[model samples]
Target chain A: MNAELPRRAWLRQNAAAVAGLVFGGAATAATRRAASPHRLVWQIDPKKCVQCGRCMTNCVLVPSAVKCVHNFDQCGYCRLCFGYFDPGATELTTAAENQMCPTGAIRRRFIEPPYYEYSIVEDLCTGCGKCVKGCTTFGNGSLQLQILHHRCVQCNECAIARRCPAQAIHRVPVEHAYRMKSQAASVTATWRHKEDGPAHA
Target chain B: MPKRSRIWAWSWTLVVAASVLVASGVQRFPKPDFRSGYTVPQYTPPAVERTAAREWLDVGLLTGGLVLAGYFALARRSRRGLWILSVASLVWFGLVRKGCVCPVGSIQNVVLGLVSPADGIPWTVAGIFLLPLVAALVVGRVFCAGVCPLGAIQDLVIFRWRPLPLWLRQFLGMIPPTYLAFAVANVAVGAGFWICRYDPFVGLFRRSGPAGLIALGWILLLIGTVVPRPYCRFLCPYGVLLGWCSQLSRRHLTISPDQCIQCRLCEESCPFDAIRVPTPPHPDRAAARRRMVYALVLAPAWVVLGAVAGWAAADPLAAKVHPDCALAAELRTEESTGKKEQSWETRVFRASGRPLEQAEEADRDARRRLRRAWAWAGAWVGGVFAVRRIALGRRSELADYVPDRGQCLSCGRCFAYCPREYVRLGELDGIRGQP
Candidate 1:
């Protein structure tokens, strides 16, 4: 009987911790279930990215976390992209030495006439805002940082709020975030090449 | 003087081995542009290469080996062996591998947190980083003890001795798992590795970056006051994970009863409390039985309860028992005045792609199924347990074999390898401030 009182007293004193642990266990389980069918919370709107370079510069991480992604259809395949080359290139060429953005985030691929492919090496991106600035000012506003939704912290209020010009940034529901740009109708019409078709949705 | 000699000797040996491997690997493996970063370059098509050395290095093989070795030595009371193995792992993993094989990819977490996207976290890279860590846990800090380049580096530099109390150590140990769960969950939800953002060693090793190096330098310098390698003990979730692994280590470091001379030197020596009182002569049979019963009861209960509760929790109208879930958040956001907003899981049950009617009548069938599943599972598990105790009235013979992957992260192994865990400081004192 005496032991019962001590045990009850001990339980009462540690009630909060016990409750916290129980609650924590349930929360852990819920988090696991929620994680199973992963969703894209942040999205990149290909239409708005000016490639202003703000993503590289204004990001909180040391090696600016903003990595450039590609939209194969919209690219001009111009001998040069302000996104790739510096202020001015001596000539349109694929020389390793004469590129623009410092970290070589862009990779060029050849695919028939007037449509060479360009890709971003995400790990190499420093989010320096240089590419964004160049692309927005000189080329199609294609190379923008759309938060990758996967890499973003989803801060209640975004940390980059103060620096974002154009005011283009806004949160959307997670389900609708990654609305892939529709396939270019012309490409869809031509069934000559299976490889040249629209990307997976 | 004795420690410094060990450090010097190990450093030289590591340099030679690293140089040979790099040379051989360079010859055998394809080389990506090493100078690609430095040269003022635009978009260049860098060539890709396939090399076995690069593959293993990238996967953190050396670090894993070194950590395992260092912990083995520590557990066995060979200080010289501990220092050598620890140093080798850190140098190879950090300096040669170029910071790629890291579980600390916070970028993924950041993205998840920002967008709250519905895609599962990418496990490919995470799996690679965790493999060696898991191995270390199973075999003891074999990773931190000998292979983790970071722990190895810190192991070489530690110079002092002050012991922390057990209660405080346990308290601090508790913090990393929470951090790990949060980091992993956030990453799964699209947030990048959040913990890596504040990693102090990255700055220190790079030699010079931002002024944060000054703060890091002071942390290293404080080794003079307390025992050396403080971070492994108090921080480093990776180490905690390994310590748990060490408990079940297959190829473990064991004391040779004859070689020991019964000096009890190793007991005093272990900074991590790893050299526990030689497992009591005979295990406490009563306590063991009780623990076995508890685990036997709890394991099946968790699986059964988990499924049922998972179903119940999915109902939007149900009261939230799990905090911090995205589903729970959705439920909280629903602005129903009186009539309950139906659960997301419940909504999922309706004809696919069809929207739910706000009225409960539409959900009648779905609600019945949900309740039935929950009740049936719970009742079935409960009945089994009751029957087991009543029919057998005896203890379970088999031991529980739960994997440490989810719950027991591998950080403790790293802590065990570091000699600095012995240090007992009240709080981070007037440490040098960073600009």
Candidate 2:
């Protein structure tokens, strides 16, 4: 009986060792397979974006990956820019009521009479797309929402992309990092012409 | 009173008075009017840019820390080295890194990766998640000894070494598995990482987060000072996995480098109560057999009860996990009441131009998934409890005191207390020539 007990114990120990080896090997293999270098990162396309405010709330991160990127060339430097002032604004001023951005991300500076230059405060921009919607709707889409690559942790599957109404977000090559709108030369030219009309007429 | 004590008392008083003065000075000037002509300055906060290089550097640091931990715990057998390493890890991983992409929270990422392969995981994240477990398999939980920032922070504050009753310890021990299951279920159902969301230390590491989370972090730190790694031992879902790996570790840290001399000197040395005392031979084999059989019979019953309870609570839990379900419900109530006012989420949904039925269907789908997940979670918890009960009931005789395999953190605290270890290190001369 004593001999049988030792034999049973030894058998049990060996069996456990074998089980551990098998499971550990399988786990290692699975992890290696799952961790492939050929992985796609999620990105937002500025042109396709609808600016539905989902990017801010739907992102897994507290601060969303999306941020407003300004194309200085595309901006017409208009005093009454639709992106900065609310559509229903009583006056073209930097009042809280007149601001289109909920977080006051857009900063306006007076350049000359009837002309103002606007810059985006990236920190305050919640990537809510409120200002982007305003810009796209009534003005040249100069202020567009793009995935700030530096802020993006680059999740394999973006939470916001899944919820995007426009389905604007898609995987892009790391080399072709950002999907920026081409400088809206036509829109800028037209806006400049409209401003010139008041001066010359 | 001692001179030092008096000096300390005076210093504290001065500090408190200074703080009070500062606080009073900062009181809000009662706004003269609701809309004052105060134009807020337009300034940009410094942007913290995350680069691929930085992520790789973090991974490299993690790997180096693990290697150092293994060496200190297993080869060097130096408790001081472990302490130094712990402090370094606390600074680098906790304060410097702000506790993101941590191994503790990486479990969710690994799960998400496996279940939803379409949403791939970063290589660094996978490495961070698996490296510690692999290390545990080879050399026990060296990660817990000094590499884990969470454990390091708690280890530093541990002043009291009081041991809880075995029954209480066993009961509380079940919480980690439950937490693990809950976190997995939340992730599986597409709810954001709840573990990372509620990490007690992250807020402190960042120096700022939600006020409620910061308060919770402070409270946990206070408890940790007395309880000795209350979070790691009782609540860390990741620790449960590490414990399992450590159990099957090929080579683990031993209290004595040579052999235990049965001196009983190291009994009260471990603050975490990871030491196991020798057990006498069983007197009644028949009673033990009967108890084992009884546990086996009752296991299924326990599982069923747990499942039923989970199913009953599924509705509330489901509402919490389903992203838009709760909001949609609230929107329904508002609509019924003829209220035009709507929350941002509801307004966004309305503006999306998607059919209301689609939103309702999505909510229903999420609820159904959550219900299934909760049921599984409950069963998992119940099974864990049953297994723990069964394991506790089974016992074998031991000749000497030894570190409990599952609970031992390889912290090297017990190593110093073991006289045999001192003899091995050549610090103490043995009466007989060393073997």
Candidate 3:
């Protein structure tokens, strides 16, 4: 009976060894099947963002990693840029009172008679999404917010993503990290998928 | 070529193919006809995307740290080396990275990946997750001793501690497995990664967060000064798995360099209460046999009862936690009350143009998934309890005091406390130990 006990223990040890090997093999198989060279990081889907302004305040960084980026292709370049100017502003002058951005991040440049170019000065942008709300409402929604990877001390789980009412923030492969305003049409449809690369890259 | 090599080759081919699929992401639009020679500048995103290099670096650092921690605990037998490594780990993995690239949170990715293969885990996360487990399987939890930032932070803060009473320690030991079950279940149900959501030290690492959570972190740290690694011992889900692997370790850290000298100092020094003194096998073989039989018999019953309990509680739990379920509940209340002022969630749902039927359908699906996940989780927890019971039932012979293989963090604190260890280290002369 004592000899049998040792034998049984030996068998148990071997079984455990086999189980560990099987687990390792299965994990390796899964990794091989995945074959993903890219890492996953959090980003906002522009289509899903509700302009709740949580990105402005909820980020761990002091000034927030989220910044406004213009999709120039989608820009209307309107003489009256809704994103750059406040609706309540009595005059059309480029005054601090008339500017929509809290920090005056948007710079309006004249291109032609009816075309006024708008660009985002990222450092000044607070990612407040006030301009985003105005632009989405009145313009082509060209001025949208994106998480700048430079400033983003990429947390495993983003603080803003937890409270995002839109549930817009999600993990995407590094290639799809920049879900900017222009890629809005195509990015959300396929970005989350691991097997497929982004629509363009 | 062997089958394994062929498989590897095939995977590499697929990887190359995937990379080839990458195309220029630049999208251009027709310019507004301007008489002025105003050419639109090429679009360039302000910040470069964080490369895979950094994530790979994290994997390398983690591996190196674990190896060094094991060396310090075993070969060098230096607690000072472990402490210095702990501080370094706290600075790098804890503060510099802002608590990302963590093995503890990687369990969620693994769960999520397996649950939904479409959402496969990143290769780096898989590496990070498996490394510590593999290390633990080979040697006792060297990762926990000085490498894990969470443990390191707590360990560094430990000024002095009083070991909890055995009864309290055993009772509190139940918490980690329960925490693990829920955390795994939550991810399996696709609810969310609650571990990352509720990380205690994330606020401290980031240095800016909600005031309440930061205060809670500080409170835990204060408690940590009097209780060594309260989180690791009683709460960490990863620790439960590490403990199991550690229990089955091929090699484990020894209290003494050569052999124990029957000194009580090591026991006095150990804050974690992981030391076990020598004991003879139980005298009554019949009683021991009966207890073991009872434990084996009750294990199935425990699993069944757990599953039933889990199934019963699933709906109520999901309502409180699951986003879809919460949203549905909120929407129903708003409609029934005819409330005009809508919450942010309700406003978002209404604006989504998703019909109430569709939303309710999603909620039902989430609830069903949650129930299934809970049942599996419950069964796993029950199995763990059964294993614990069986271990407790067993009677074993030991010749000397030793660190409990399952609970020991391999921190090397007990080494100095052992008089024999001093003899081995040549601090005390004329004692023959391992040359």
Best by DockQ: 3
B129 in model 3: Cα distance from truth in Å? 0.7
Cα shift from native, residue A141, model 2 (Å): 4.0
Over the full model, what C-alpha lDDT does candidate 1 score relative to the true structure? 0.45
Candidate 1, residue B2: the lDDT equals 100
Task: Supply fnat for every model shown.
Answer: 0.03, 0.05, 0.29
Interface RMSD of each: 17.4, 15.5, 5.0
lDDT value, candidate 2, whole model: 0.74
Error in Å for residue B272 of model 1: 3.1
The sequence of per-residue lDDT tens digits that candidate 1 reaches over residues A1-201 is 012256654654364344334433433333343334232233344333444455555544455534565543334445567778776678656676667768777777655443345678887877665766666455543455545544554333343432343333544334344422232222222311221221221
Report the alpha-carbon TM-score of model 2 versus the true structure: 0.77
lDDT of each: 0.45, 0.74, 0.79
CAPRI tier of model 2: incorrect
- Candidate 3 structure quality by residue, lDDT tens digits, A93-172: 78999989989888888777877788889889999999998887766677778888888877766888877999888777
Candidate 1 true-interface contact recovery: 0.03
The residue-level lDDT of candidate 2 at B285 comes to 86
Query: Per-residue lDDT for B86-136 in model 1, tens only?
Result: 565456546544343354432233234233323223333334445554454
DockQ for each numbered candidate: 0.06, 0.05, 0.30
Report the C-alpha displacement of residue A46, candidate 3, in angstroms.
1.6
